[model samples]
Target: MTETPGASGAPSVRLTAGDAEVTILPAAGCRIASLRVGGLELLRQGDHYGCFPMVPWCGRTAQGRFRNGGVTHQLPINAAPHAIHGTGRDVAWDRLPSLEENEAVFSYELAEPWPYPGRVVQSFELTPDSLRLTMGVETADDSFPAQAGWHPWFRRNLGGEDVAVDFSPVWQEERGADHLPTGDRIEPRPGPWDDCFGMPDGVDVALTWPEQLRLRVTSPTPWVVVYDEQPEAVCVEPQSGPPNGLNTCPRLVTKIDPLEITASFTWERLG
Candidate 1:
């Protein structure tokens, strides 16, 4: 399928299968504006960022405030003192008609500086090499704390070479000095990273473009961040907690508990 004119005007959506292609923008925040595989182009061609979707709360929620029970809420710093990646990629998304053509669905609504009152629902499925993603956050009345993830900029050089980031991660959240996450957990530090990693047996990672393609990002969500210092692009981010995690590991999204997360990338091609 295909369309154009999105980013609030609504329309963008493309998907193929065998040789893989994707280009969903559903009003921009449904992001993933391109992901060609055999024909190359692994993301990062931009409309701000290629693969985005980090709702309710995902990374950095420190100075932007948090605390739900007694009420704290602040937000809106927009990555200066914290409060990065949330507000659902900065709004606009609501596509859901799905007859199936690689699967798609989107939704949004979690207003203000996000004091509560939620909705966020995302889904995509694409498959040729793989791309499944899913996200959630709900609140019929209100509860609070939330998180979800996927922030793939990718593309560190896909002409062949310059994308190496494999992962094992068991610990490593020691990042502070305003980068947030200093609850300490250290040990896997090395990357040209922005920090945060812990696998709990999920959240796998790998980017490798040594000869061509290799993307493997998986995620049952145990947390992941890994920014590659950016010469161009390379972020892993599978987040669902960590990075102030709504004032340190919280995760309640009322109306009968709703706050889900998922990620999957899967790829292969090297020669």
Candidate 2:
């Protein structure tokens, strides 16, 4: 895989705080390659990276089809039968110039198949115990529907300890056979879920690995999708909207206002 510079000329970026460390790859969709807190790895590091940025839109768009301003746009179905995780994960992002050791930013512009002219900015702020992620999308010439978020695939176990999830979302969005929300919000069900959920207040989830580590995920957004079907990893995604949200609850980014969201993951050593 090709690598990108941390700034204008640096090959890569690494942030360190206490025993915590983070590696950001600007070329690989500006994704987080690794997030290690002490001797424990909190993220699942692999070909997809530990975490990736989902921009312009989060999740699927219903068979890769959506209508805006009377124009129908079709996106490439990267996830089979649907366009998933937005195009940001498949494109190159420009690393913004910054001198901070614990912060990095990357930017990307909308291109073909998206049928929109806009720019997306993603930033990461790292501390001794947490990583704050922020994303924003905006169009200068026209208003375009958009969403933003992160997909962090966390390891199911840490230091040989099984992971446990704890959260209380307001409702679960019943998923259809195609994995799209059915527009029905029912009581939250027990995982392994690959569905979106309503968080009337905000997104807050805690994951604990007994005798290993404890971590908390928080976002101000009202929607979150939790996927725990995998034996190796679990995903607790926070986003501005849900799957097929373009047709359900579209958030338009105009010349004056942009769609922006922020989420933070804090971890602590246990045992």
Candidate 3:
């Protein structure tokens, strides 16, 4: 995992308020390269390892295919059998003006491999206790299905205790052997999970590093995918929809209205 500097020769953007600090890489998928609270880094180190915006779509679009208005469109399969994440994460975004130093915005226009003309905007804002992430997508012409979310790879250990994940999901999306949901809802199972969970009341998950810190990840989105199989990090992702949502639960982004979603991570020192 490498942490990339901003576009060209530009340095990454850093925002500080109180004891919290945030580093963002606009050229590297507009991911949060580093997040520190109470003088301890919460996110896993590296460029591709930090939290990144998953826009237009989240997770995988099964077999890289979807239908809009009765027309079938195929996406470039970057994750073998499916298109993982989205095109937004693989391109450099253009920075937009912000009235405050603690907040920055970046935008990218959809291009080839996407089969649409649209714009995606991602914003990162930091306060003393939390970091807020907002994402939106609006099509330039035709209406299209879309989704937005965040994938944050937080460190399992905070140099003290390994982080513990806690959350109550309404149900789990039964995963098929191919790794896509089987369209069946079942009881939430025990980890190590690489599955998506339902939280119709909204997503609220906690990560605790005993005697170190506690972070609460919250979002109004009803879907979340938790991946804890990795030895070094734990991911708590909040999404606007489920994986393969393009085919099963499409959220339309049109010229009149755009699809938008937001998530936040708030933390407190613990003993």
Q: Using TM-score, give the best candidate's number.
A: 3
Supply the global lDDT for candidate 3: 0.89
By descending TM-score, how would the candidates be arranged? Answer: 3, 2, 1
> For candidate 1, lDDT tens digit of each residue in 79-123?
787777887876778887878878888898888878767788898
Task: Identify the runs in model 2 with alpha carbons over 4 angstroms from their true place.
Answer: 1-10
The global C-alpha lDDT for each of the candidates, from Candidate 1 onward, is 0.83, 0.85, 0.89
Which model is ahead, 1 or 3, in terms of lDDT? 3
Over 167-256, each residue of candidate 3 has an lDDT whose tens digit, in order, gives 999999999988899999999999999999999999999999998888999999999999999899999999999999999999899888
Give each prediction's root-mean-square deviation over alpha carbons.
13.7, 3.0, 2.7
Of the candidates shown, which would achieve the greatest lDDT relative to the real structure? Answer: 3
Worst 10 residues of 3 by lDDT: 1-10
- C-alpha displacement of 156 in model 3, angstroms? 0.4
Check candidate 3 and list the clashing pairs: 2-47, 3-47
lDDT of 1 at 138: 90
